[model samples]
Target: MSTDVAALTPAEARARFRDGLHVPTSGWCAGYAQANLIIVPKDYAFDTLLFAQRNPKPCPILGVLDAGETTGPLLRGGDIRTDLPAYTVYRDGELVETVTDLSEHWRDDLVTFIVGCSFTFEAPLLQAGIPIAHIDQGCNVPMYRTSIRCESAGRMAGPMVVSMRPIPATRVSDAVRITSRYPAVHGAPVHVGDPSRIGISDLSRPNFGEPVTVPDGTIPVFWACGVTPQAAVMESRPPIAFGHAPGCMLITDAADTDYLIP
Candidate 1:
């Protein structure tokens, strides 16, 4: 397997996952849009949609599938149950298991929400010469559960989750300006510098994903994470919910340029 992951099309990458390639999808299919997944029973669908509506930064929805519908515009012919590299299953708010496929867990009344992912903007960030530590380190980006709570929507209420990247002191502004153009994919940094201010006491350990090396001259920058829905599921605990494992996004057929604004 000497394939270049970044060069593969979204369909090809998804095919690999369907065949059991389980891995975090941060840097794969470099020029395409990626998405976070959140599935809930039809009973909680409205509450979940309202949650995303109330919190756009972390839950910017790309496309939604009807109850029991698997494929849609964002996915083309792909099946949500088997397309992503990994899936996180939550049982009554408790993370039960992580799996490569969701075939066994399928339900007739389930609705899937495809949320925009920060990885969609990483290409532009790299083009602008802003280093993304996790990609360079070949690991999952660090994600932390912050002290800040998101605006509540019905039974969906929980703390905001954030993904961190160490930006050099000099290019922090450049990173912000470049990313702000892509609001659909989490836009700019929410909180820059001093992770402690947001209740992250240790950079070495993250609540989700692997921590990266933060150089001496680099300042840790955070963007609202798509993982916030998973947090909501944890706190609110609907009967059962499904999400892409943090950083293991569903690579969409849409081009990254589609989300960019002038």
Candidate 2:
């Protein structure tokens, strides 16, 4: 809940992340777009890319890196290996560890992919007079794994993931119209109201991220989450894979407006 971190510019924020400030990227660089990170061996790059292509709502590809590359030009000077606050390492479908830096994990055959995060749209929502419960509560957005399955792409396939926000029932349409402007991000609610309809039995406990208070007169809104890639990793079980821990997105230099649809 530090306003100091939230006030930093994208470059300054990334400088801290590079210097070892391991934390979630929410509410930082308020007008900039944040992204989810995923790295896989080149051998599985195609399958991962295909998975993203087939399921853009849950896995919108923001940028992709060639084998062995760490810097991504499309992200406005962000470094793929060190920009994110924390990374989750998986080996043969099992989570092995969560680390802050990827320098030691770097390999010549690794390819990195950046996925659009809903954080990019939060700024606009706030500006548009929509309430974001998690931001107001100063916590990471709640995310859940749903029974809804993603289309298979070679070895990449799994259940779709979603991030939830509590919206005032009166403003649900405004939330949808404003967020739908950014297709590069998740771009709008995939589900609303009851969590059980999407297979989420508990709203108090999320599969990833912290749960928030849903006050009276508010309805739950869900958007396809960037963490969907992790579900794919669990099912695809690539020999090796790496991704950003939920809420710990890569703060990019790109403006939030950059992704807005005209």
| Candidate number of the best TM-score | 1
State each candidate's clash count: 0, 0
Q: Per-residue alpha-carbon lDDT of model 1 for 98-177, expressed as tens digits? A: 99999999999999999999999998888888888998898999999999899999999999999999999999999999
After the best TM-score superposition of candidate 2, give how far the Cα of residue 260 lies from its true spot, in angstroms: 0.8
Q: Each candidate's TM vs. the true structure?
A: 0.98, 0.96
Reference-based lDDT, residue 136, model 2? 83
**Off by more than 4 A, model 1:** 1-3
Clashes of 2: 0
lDDT by residue (160-231, candidate 2, tens digit) is: 999999999999999999999998999988998999999999999999999999989999999999999998
lDDT of 2: 0.90
Question: What do the candidate models score in CA lDDT, each in turn?
Answer: 0.93, 0.90
For candidate 1, give the lDDT: 0.93
Q: Model 1 misses residue 61 by how many Å? A: 0.6
